[model samples]
Target: MTKKLIYNGTVLTMNPDRSVYKPGYVYIEHDTIREVGEWPQDGSKQALLESASWVHDAEGKVIVPGLVNTHTHLFQTFIRGVSDDMPLAQWLRQIIWPSSLAMEAEDFYLAALIGCIENLKSGATYIMDHHYVHTYPENDDGVLRAMEESGIRGCMARGGVDLSYEPKLRETEEEIFANTDKLLDQWDGAASGRIEIAMGPLNLYGCSRAFLEHAAKYSERRQLISHIHVAETSDQIENTKARFGLRNLELLEAVGLLGPKTQVVHGVWLDDGELESIARAKASVVHCPVSNMYLASGVARVPDMLKLGINVALGTDGPGSNNCQDNLEVLKFTACLHKVNQLDSTLLPPMEVLQLATVNGARAMGRERDLGSLEPGKKADVVVVDLRKAHISPVHRASSALVYNANGNDVDTVLVNGQVVVEHGACTLVDEQEIIRRAQARVDRLRAKLAPEYPVFRVVE
Candidate 1:
């Protein structure tokens, strides 16, 4: 087997004990980690390191596990900057739905490729794209193909809204379930298990109750994940209560959809009881601080959720809301937003914030054992952030500097499953510049398809 060694860096092992090794080394064989600890001093260890097939000197850098983004609409990358300051409902009515419904397969493919390049540079090796735009039958294939070609671990949570949503985004019963099954047969575990398929119902109000139950059961029998947006805004909660006479999470529980594999996205409006319900069901909540604030969707109860034993992960939501696919930005926003929201400086330190982006996100995708930390026998999904920049010069605490001062541009190298997908701050597998040009061109074309005013919120029912 081929071997590679990376040493002379600050290794942030987000393990159970949260170990940090300065001037450390990690040895990998093939795609699995073999050894990781302090730099070797003894001759035998040094000799063993010299026997590796390849060695990378990560001097003046911080080596950490690749960040996992639990929730994002990657296809929305094409519509970024479409509507910046609009309210959440209006933004969806005007920008997200209109542009998404206009996109074809090629649109999804190019958008996902662009999103992958952005995500890779930001140190995210694993991304869950909550893709539901199904204008064509090949839309899912387009997204998954980009994920495979870009060499990043991804989950296309194929989402749908059968009723009470945009009419064009919905599909017939046979098409929805049959398409899901066909995708499973073709691409569920493709690319050596790097690509995973999950069941994603767009939202509670958008999907019917019976469909939610069926999706939960479908995923449960297969041991797959079920992701959905839950109580993201006050209107969502009010509407669910008005129609079903039950709160969002309560309605989910009544439909037998609350379980450990459920990933609740943008859980901003959940109350105390709903938090308790999520904790009891062992579900994970994906906190998108930047997107929530951008859309004026109030801050999520992240501090309360953590204190109540609910696992929380971080996400950027989508480009339309966040305008970027950088988790480093999300990390800083998550820490700062909570600290100020709770008026406690020590609310979320940089170390815990790193966990929210790394381990907590891994748990949300049900890949805790395979991903999340740098240890022996785990997948070699690693990222190297150069701390030698002028802004990050003389770094005292590596994690603190990474969380507070660093952004996506600080990442110098990234690896997914021992493959160097990004090197020297650019994607290695795809043409970054060409993707940019094509993506911009596609966005311009998509803009032409939308009418000037769109009749003001006619997309939403």
Candidate 2:
């Protein structure tokens, strides 16, 4: 087996004790980390390093576990900057829904490729794509193909909305279940287990009670994780209460959807009792601070969630809303947003914010044991940040610099499953420029199609 060694850098283990080793080394054998610690002074270790197939000298760099984006819509990359400064309901109704209907299967593939390229360059190793824009079966296939080609670890939350206000996007209950079952059977554990499939009901506002009940039952029977948007806007809670006489979380609990294997996105408008119920069910919430802020959605009670021992993870939401897939930006925003909102600078420290992006995110995805931290026998998903930049010079504490100072553009090298996918801030697997060109071409066509009815937001380059 091929062995690789990365040495002579600051390694942030991000383990349970949050260890940091100056001028440390990590030994990797194929797809798993063999050892991670300070560089050995002994001759035996020196000899082993000399005999390795590949050695990466990470001098003047910071090595950390790859960031995880627990929730995002890959297909939304096509709709970036489409409907900004609008309310959530209007944005969804006018721009997002119409643009989604106009997209072909090829559009989804190109958009997903662009999203994956952005995520990789941003030091994100895994992405949970909550893709619910599939009007055709081929659209889902296109997304999976892009994930495979991009060589990023992906969780495809195959999504369907049974009660969408947009008629073209809605599906019958039987059709949605059939599509979900077919996708799971075909794609689960595909790409050498690099790809995972999860069940996703669009949301409480858009999916019927019967549909959610069926989704919950299917998830339980198949032991698959269930993901859905919850309490993202005040309208969602109000509409759910109006229809079912229960709040969003209450409706989810009544339909047997709240459990350890469920991940609720947003949760920005949840009350204290709802937070308690989520913590009690052992469920996780993914906080998308930038998206929430960009859309004018109120900040989530992240401090309250963390205080209650609920596993809170970080996400970028979607390219359409957030306009970027950079986890480093998300990390910084999570740290700063909570501090200011709570009126306490000590609320979310650098270490805790780092955890929210890495281990905590892994826990939310139920892959905590293998995917999160840097330890022996864990998957060698690693990112190397070049600290030689002027902005990141004279690193005080590696963790602090990583969260507060270093942006995603500082990411120099990235490895997923011990395979180097990005080097020197360039993707090794896909032609990034070509991907961008194709995505832009699709967007151009979409703008032409949308100009007649909706005023296309022209961005002058």
Candidate 3:
């Protein structure tokens, strides 16, 4: 029996009561947390330290539930900052579409490796990657291989767009299902169940009704989540309404897709009725604050969604849109962006924002019972953030320091399933420098393949 102990840290349980144990300790047996509370009253600490196989003194650090990222696209790591300052529509056509055609199988593997490392360094132990680009037959497989190698908890939302203008990016309903089935057969619940599969139909404009219905039925039958982008921009809302009489969520409902396991990404232009619809269906809406602001895609009604009893979670989106895969960065953005949007200082306090990333994110992934809190019997996915640093010190509130001040660099350690995958802010399973080098080579090669007019090749004056 492998036993591990992380003691002398400030523990944010993220439980229903929002418990915090200053100078607390957590005991893990195998892959589950066996005990976690304020330094115990019993004289078992010394005995535990002596008996545990691994021990880490977490003094001057804050231990948090591993951040859950409900949405992202790992394939974008190669083309992030290159396509900047463009709206969603133009960004898709000029950057993502062109890059999709240029990317090869190896490119997907390298992108997922670096993207997973970035998320680990950022204290994101659980990620729902909405990876949709499937230009090559082995592209998704390479991504799955990287996910397995990274040793982080992940859900690869295999994305398909049957209605895209870009032929290379489009897949027929049969192709989407066949590919999804193949991936599920090979990778679902692989890596000791750290990896999962989800059906990701791109969006209203990108997928046909027949395609969506097939995806919904397949995912529902398998008890997997159906993740999709919806109402991200005003133009999408108008376009979908024009093409189909119903709005994005309305169409999803018509196709029997709106349910508890549906993850609706970027509900930016949703109306009150639509918000209520999501709440009634018990579906989750992921808020990607940085991406929304980056694309000038208006802020999602996160606060209102929370008020309507909808499960609202946080995501960094794809790096192509967010420019980085740092979920911790999303935490700060979510707190500040919504407060400014609502013009209310008292709204979305630090603890509440933390919930959006932790517990709410777990709920979004249907793993709330096993993955969200530091409670006993939960998965031992924890992060230790060094709070003794310059920007985080004086030991105010752990939650405040985390959401308002702490960046990804503040993360000192990350553990997934009781395994120390990142120690001292570096990935343990793979050579970090090597991953970055390979990804850059792939990006350089990809850029060579794309036209000069693409944002990546445009030389800034």
Q: lDDT winner among the candidates?
A: 2
Q: What TM-score against the true fold does each predicted structure earn? A: 0.96, 0.98, 0.98
Model 2: lowest-lDDT 10 consecutive positions: 452-461
lDDT per residue for candidate 3 within 127-230, as digits (tens), equals 99998887787888888888889988999998888885577778788888888888889999899999999988888887788888887788889898999999
Candidate 2 residue spans exceeding 4 A from truth: 41-44, 457-461
lDDT of 2 at 446: 83
Quote the RMSD, in angstroms, for model 3: 1.4
For model 2, residues 391-431, the per-residue Cα lDDT tens digits are: 87888888888888888899999988998889889999999
* Per-residue error (Å), model 3, residue 121: 0.7
In candidate 3, stretches whose alpha carbon ends up further than 4 angstroms from where it belongs are 40-44, 451-461
Number of backbone collisions per candidate, in order? 0, 0, 0
Q: Name model 1 segments beyond 4 Å from true.
A: 41-44, 451-461
Position 402, candidate 2: lDDT: 86
Error of 2 at 361 (Å): 0.7
